[model samples]
Target: MIQQPFFTPAILLVLFAIPLALGWVPRNRFYGIRTRRALADDAAWYRINRSGAWCLIVSGLFYLAVAWVVPMSGPQDVNFRLWLLHLFAFVLPLLLGLVRIRHLSRQD
Candidate 1:
């Protein structure tokens, strides 16, 4: 059986979210949502960042669910399954978060 480190994504996402979720991060080019609208306004920065952080939390929970319910297959199928898992775990929430941010930042 192949050993799978299925918890990595959730851990990473949650770790990334802590600062943003808590409003510990300031508006800057290096971190958080640095979109023109988010960067330009202090309020938008915190709101958008918090929303994005929630997205990360949601994504991490989804990862935990996937890890629990997903069945591992033989070695031959491991690579493909891992790839698909990564795509679903990361891409869906990211796209949703970006769409949310786009709408939010445009509002004000």
Candidate 2:
């Protein structure tokens, strides 16, 4: 019997977690180095706030959708559901991010 690679979904899930965990910390501690040059001093906090919220929303949706989609090893095909989830996951957050970025930009 061929040994199959273990499909630990948690490992995949952690890919989603690590970034948000780091992002939740003090801005200068986790993301400060990246922002030190590009973001205006005033915009830095706004940028972090907006991005962290976006990440939380996106990652939560992604993990939930993946959990729903990955366990369809039955007679029914779930490709359409997966596709729909992917579409929403891709588009909604992008639209929200754009709107939030515009709002944040206008603040400064």
Candidate 3:
């Protein structure tokens, strides 16, 4: 069995968001944006989610790359590094999404 990487948030986010970015996933309360502005209309939902998806994809890839490049030694050190990278994986995409949302909202 192929061992799955412990850190898979990046990969999972990339996989989940790509379809949404491509418009394959319809706007819904379950998956897409639940924000007032994004849920205000279908168009806004698509636009904001599309941008958010791309941001997530990019951030995920970045986290994956960084994790791959940084060599981790033993369990103790690996855990710390992994935690930091995981935090980055979550935060960077969120910041990017916020920036994208600001830009998209301005267009309206």
Which predicted model would earn the best lDDT?
Answer: 1
The Cα local distance difference test for each model comes to 0.74, 0.46, 0.70
| CA deviation > 4 Å runs, candidate 2 | 1-38, 46-78
Best by TM-score: 1
- Models 1 onward score TM values of 0.75, 0.39, 0.72
How would you encode candidate 1's per-residue C-alpha lDDT over 1-108 as one tens digit per residue? 123344665677788888998999999999887788889989989998898888777877776666566745534455785758755765687677778767877886
Q: After superposition, how far is residue 26 of candidate 2 from its true place, in Å?
A: 8.5
Report the lDDT tens digits of candidate 3 across residue range 1-108: 012143466678789889878987776779864577777788888888888788878877776666566634534454765667656655776687668767776576
**Tens digit of lDDT per residue, candidate 2, span 1-108?**
011111233234345445543554344545432344225453465455546455545554554555455543433545777545544654565466557545544553
Alpha-carbon RMSD of each model:
3.2, 7.1, 3.5
For model 2 the TM-score comes to 0.39
In every candidate, how many clashes are there? 0, 0, 0
Q: Compute the lDDT of residue 85 as modeled in candidate 3.
A: 64
TM-score of 3: 0.72
